[model samples]
Target chain A: MLRLIGIGLNPKKHMTLEALEKINDSDEIYLELYTSRIVDMTLDELENLINRKITLLDRKTIESEFLVERSRKMKVSLLVPGDPIIATTHIGLVISSIQNNVEYEIINGISVQCVVPSILGLQNYKFGRSVSIPFPEYDYYPESVYNFVLENRKLGLHTLVFLDLRESLEMSALMGIDILLKMESMYRKDAIDKNTIIAVISKAGSEKQRAIADKIERIKERDLGPTPHIMVIIGSLHYMELEALKKLASFPENENINLL
Target chain B: MLRLIGIGLNPKKHMTLEALEKINDSDEIYLELYTSRIVDMTLDELENLINRKITLLDRKTIESEFLVERSRKMKVSLLVPGDPIIATTHIGLVISSIQNNVEYEIINGISVQCVVPSILGLQNYKFGRSVSIPFPEYDYYPESVYNFVLENRKLGLHTLVFLDLRESLEMSALMGIDILLKMESMYRKDAIDKNTIIAVISKAGSEKQRAIADKIERIKERDLGPTPHIMVIIGSLHYMELEALKKLASFPENENINLL
Candidate 1:
């Protein structure tokens, strides 16, 4: 049997009891950190918390058939950061399990997508489709991310922007801000500008989590500690939502702003 | 201080360690079940698991100043059925905390929105804004829910439809199908029909959870056990997603399907 379990944000405290039980029952456990990083958690600390040896799987090993093959013979569990299967690559494993006739289960966890809205005092149903800002390389920047934001804005829904995380390279909120600004310059559609309001949440679901909502220019200058940050582009805001943003996210009061 | 803690779907096995610790440290722990129900677990079973007496709060009490007033003097935790703050009423508590000078923290959990996609092997990012179906009353049926599903479908995004749970009353999947059919007749947008493909997930995140995807007509005939059911209206499906649905969700192989 194979199980894809989510270890939420903080490995020390965010794992569900079912996740712990599954981890304990597995013959071999693997932890995948290429898709996301756990805040302030070392592999050794995680190993100690569960009191089991964990084999770290890189992207190549995870996507390969090694896990399926192992699960066919014995129990194997892959501990994912945040919710399992949110990353498309994990879906490949489920498909492989089916083809190989290896029974598999998905154990859910606290996702950043859900946590961000709760922490920011925003309604979850008010969020539109989430977008990811990939790290732009030479001649390889995709504008679909910007277009998705526009589509969400047009519907008066907030957009959760996921920063890029390619193996060892993690994108920070500052880097994401620069990418958005660059997109604005390239497209000139006025989708994003220094004056546009955005919320940058750092270390979400952790004790050190900090959220700051302000215009692009000032928000980019502020210090939102640590890695694994997600950004939210505000759309329409209700009066209570606006008040919560002001109190919880350090959003400045602007009398000219319109409310839904 | 007041902390809004999410017990996820099943209180027995879905809570994080942070949730347990906070519940233990809290001077007063309250569980609000009027919003949602815990599958196969009684209130006594939950109280026994936590080894503490829990005070139940209804909608009126939960929205009232009672919680904030008590938290002002001692530590208090409201054990929510799912991820805290998704209900919007809980956001009111956060706003009240700010007004009453009480510190608050949100401990995130595995929400149904995150869990349903994983169970069905659908990509989370492809889901648009979620909508809820209310129990239709005399002269008070809302077509906005139908419109939201149409909007999501236009974008080729999956719509997670929440079944209405009004205190002591729960709307089942059969009832939801009837309502959607009624909406289709009213709108004439061809949004939903007897042949439309939809997925119904019952008792999600629990041991007895079951998911089935098929034509709306056939799916409604099958027995999907218990309350707290959620429905997903299908959109464009990736080839792998279709394969996963077939293998995991009992979706039939249809040659006349389009893949993205």
Candidate 2:
């Protein structure tokens, strides 16, 4: 049996009761932090909390058939940072398990998509397609990120921008903002500008989580204080939503930030 | 102090350890089932599980300043069915807490948005703005539902359609599909038809959860079993996503369902 469990955003406190029970029942447990980093708790602390030894698996190992094959013989569990299948590769494992006739169960966990919008006081129904901002290489810049934001904004829908996590190094909010600026420079679509209102959230769902909404220029100067940051591009906001943003996220007063 | 705790989809088992601990420490605990229903466990079972008497609050009470006012004098907790702020009125409470000078903390939980896409083998990032299908009144036909689906489909993004719940009555998959079909008739748009492919899920995050993907006609015939049904309008599919849908969600073979 293969048990795929989501540990949520906070490694220490966000795990569901069923997820904890399943981890305790598993014969062997493995975790992967490469997909998304959890800074609140160390691996040793996680192992101690669950009272089980954990084997850290790399992307190669996870994508490979080792875990599935091992589960065919004995129970194996994979502890994911968020809801199990947020990463497409986890769904690949589900399909593989079916093909190999390995019984598998999914225990849901709190996900960034579920938590961030609520924390920022944005209605979940108003969010558009979420996009991931990647670290630009010397010659690589994906236009899809800009296109997604443009499309969502065109329809008066908010966009959730996921900062990239590559090889244990997380893309910071500053880096993400810079990438959007670069995208704006290249596209010249007026989709994003320094005057545009945006939100930057760091360490979401943790005690130290910070959320602030302001203009791009002002946000770039503030110290968000950590890695694993996510961004939200503001769109048309309902009056109640605007009020909530001001109260919960420190969004600038209406006189300071203009939507129309 | 006020704590907005998310009990997730299943009332009995979907709570996080932190949520459980906070509830135990609270001076009083409250739960509201009108926003959403939990079929896996009864109210009595939930009280027994938490070892506390729960005062059930109505929509009016939740929307009012009653909880915030109560929390000003004591530690009060509102046990939400899913993630707390998914319901916009909860954010109203958060703002009320701020206005009343009451401290509040949100403990995230598993949400249908986080779990349904994964269960259907759809990528979370590919989902567009989610829409809720209301229990249409005699003269109430929401064109926004059609427009949202149309916009999302045009972008080749999947749409998560929430089924309506009114006065402790839940909207079934059949009702949602009929509503969509009626909208299609009124709009005469090709966005939805009897042969359009879609996914219907019921009792998500529970032991008896069921997921199935097929044509609208076939899905309409399926008894998704119980309340809290969610629908997903299919969009462009990645090859791996299509495969996973087939293997995990019982999506029909590609030859049987035509995308173009």
List the lowest-lDDT window of 10 residues for candidate 1 chain B: B248-257
Q: Candidate 1, residues B135-205: lDDT per residue as tens digits?
A: 88785668788888888887888999888888678888888888888888888887777767788888887
Off by over 4 Å in 1: A188-190
Which consecutive 10 residues in model 1 chain A have the weakest lDDT in total? Answer: A188-197
**Per-candidate DockQ vs. reference:** 0.83, 0.80
Report the alpha-carbon TM-score of model 2 versus the true structure: 0.97
> Backbone clashes in each candidate structure, one number apiece?
0, 0
RMSD of each: 1.6, 1.7
Question: Candidate 1 has which clashing residue pairs, if any?
Answer: none
